[model samples]
Target: VTVCCVAADPPAEAWVKGGPVDPNLLGATTRSFLAKVLTSLMDRFEQDDDKDTVAAAGEALAQLAMLLGGPGVHSVTQRLIDTCLQLLQQEHICQSSDDELDGEEDHDGALWEAVSELLM
Candidate 1:
């Protein structure tokens, strides 16, 4: 899954190289491919317990969300938000104090921050 995330970055960077995206640049086949890859990443994110795996999947989904748009795209955005919220909920269970989070907590927090940045 980490490999998938690593693999996603370059193309994502290329796709968003210009300031604003023109959706027509992504044709039907490209959109379909992205949808498949995004779905796979989301699934991996939900199933993985390893922090690195989860973080990678989260990052990849965030990048993909930056490209996916138009009429049916709200479903994708909603699903991504739901997934991030679910991750936050799970992280919340581990919180015991306001200022005593450890390394794992930091990782989860950072991942949440990244997701938040993407959503906004």
Candidate 2:
């Protein structure tokens, strides 16, 4: 399945002459395959109605961050931050009360911690 694909190493035949070549029969590189997996997980995190499934997706994201290393994790987190910041800057985020701001702060704090851990 997708998880197995994401966890797999790229095939030896996937590279040639010290460069990436089309390994048509072989599959995608780890990074490329995992990107799809991460995107699917993120989509499910937002769209899934089942609490357990959503929770698992969230955990999967943390595990993926660990697997991806600093630069890759930064790429993922930066996309998240950019999306959130865009919502805030574009006034897409509703500020109905003080509680909303508090919630936003909580999310921001957690995101910062995740990024810091990835960097370290």
Candidate 3:
């Protein structure tokens, strides 16, 4: 989690312009770091059964996408949407009358929330 947070918010000096830049336009070092961070977060988001952890990864991915504002944003957005849709198709997300979810259901809800944040 710490690694993801740090990766999402790279050091100011890591950027070619002292701030966020398009991943494709980044230097080799920054590009490598970005790839590793994206892979790790995607892996966690896809494989983790823990709702909180998955949500965190999703949020990190969103943050990274925002940081790298370019054509990469479209790819990341598509991947997130596809993953969320796959999860929805594989499981039946249900909510109780009290607007609460449990166990696996909570995972889906949290993921949707993260995706919503990403889209916004």
Candidate 4:
């Protein structure tokens, strides 16, 4: 995951407006690899119980979306918004419950902070 994030950082600017690498820059093989990476990240984001892992996956997803710059950006943006809304709902439920939330709130708060940063 860390490796993927690092690898994506360098090519980010290239995919932006007026840059050399456009949507057509990637070959079939590279596109296939990116698809696999995106799938894996989405899976981790949805299934991971650890808040830190989920937050990292969310950041990676945002980075990958920017690097790809195509129809995928819209889909990924919507997905991230949906995920954040779900997380917010879960946090509300947790707060309303009687269970102890001292540590849980901290974890959720950090995750929310990270997701907020990515969205910005």
Candidate 5:
């Protein structure tokens, strides 16, 4: 019923490592929560014109992608692929150009690297 109830209840092993998550894992509700978190991070990255939040959001997405694994990634279709592709194409764009409004420094390399690593 609560955010804490959902996130904290999920087995930590499923999220901490990107190894093969159990096929018969996560209830429907939990899966939906994962979908929301992934979507929210991607959306946050898009809305956040600032370099810091954008970069942070990207990092969060990358981490989520990692834990989610191949099976876990079935939820996000276009958004995940688009973000990954964008990072591939603009590897150095963020590092060079950024709005420092929120004191979030830019690291183009990290963003690209994070996504790449996630998909790996």
Candidate 6:
């Protein structure tokens, strides 16, 4: 997986949704096409709190799951749940200071909520 779905720089929007490169150009298949695509994209926001990207990731994941139908989707969905939960754990760890923790008061909740909403 490509670490960090996106770089913290200009035109960051490309990391999640629309950008210089269009994902539509690539066809989805059983192989690692979409997985690698989303994996790379999600890896970007993995450490970043940008809830917008997280929400977008959730949507993208759902679409991928649907495309990879049956238990594959369920399996992928479950893995996504695990991944989101892990990210929340990491976010908690990164909140070393009280102020930082307070700042992210609802950050974890919101992130998971978006993921859950997407799954549901």
> What is the alpha-carbon lDDT of model 1 when measured against the actual structure?
0.55
Ordered by lDDT, highest first, the candidates read 4, 3, 5, 1, 2, 6
Q: What is the C-alpha lDDT of each candidate?
A: 0.55, 0.47, 0.58, 0.60, 0.56, 0.47
Distance from true position, residue 79, model 5, in Å?
Answer: 1.4
Model 5 RMSD in Å is: 5.4
Candidate 2, which ten residues in sequence have the lowest lDDT sum? 90-99
Error of 3 at 87 (Å): 3.9
Q: Best TM-score goes to which candidate?
A: 4
> In lDDT terms, how accurate is model 4?
0.60
Could you tell which candidate, 1 or 5, scores higher by lDDT?
5
- Give me the candidate number with maximum lDDT: 4
lDDT of 1 at 81: 69
Backbone clashes in model 1, listed as residue pairs: none
TM-scores for all predictions: 0.56, 0.41, 0.56, 0.57, 0.56, 0.43
The number of residue pairs in model 4 that clash at the backbone is: 0
Q: By TM-score, is 1 or 6 better?
A: 1
lDDT tens per residue, model 6, 1-120: 211221211221223232223333322333334455655555643544465466566666655544333322332445566666765565523233345455465765655665665555
Against the correct fold, how does model 5 do in TM-score?
Answer: 0.56
Q: Clashing residue pairs, candidate 5?
A: none
Candidate 1 lDDT, 2-97, residue by residue in tens: 334334542333443324455444445555566567677767666665555667777766655554433213336666667677666765222323
Which of the predicted structures, 2 or 5, would earn the higher TM-score when compared with the native?
Answer: 5
Q: Could you give candidate 5's per-residue lDDT for residues 7-114 as a string of tens digits?
A: 655654454454555533654555666666767776766555444566677766665555555445555656667766665675434534554433332354546556
| Candidate that beats the other on lDDT, 2 or 6, i.e. the better one | 2
Q: Compared with the true structure, what per-residue lDDT tens digits does model 2 show for residues 2-117?
A: 34653575344433232433333234566566556767876754455433454455556666554443323344566545533533453222222235443566554554444344
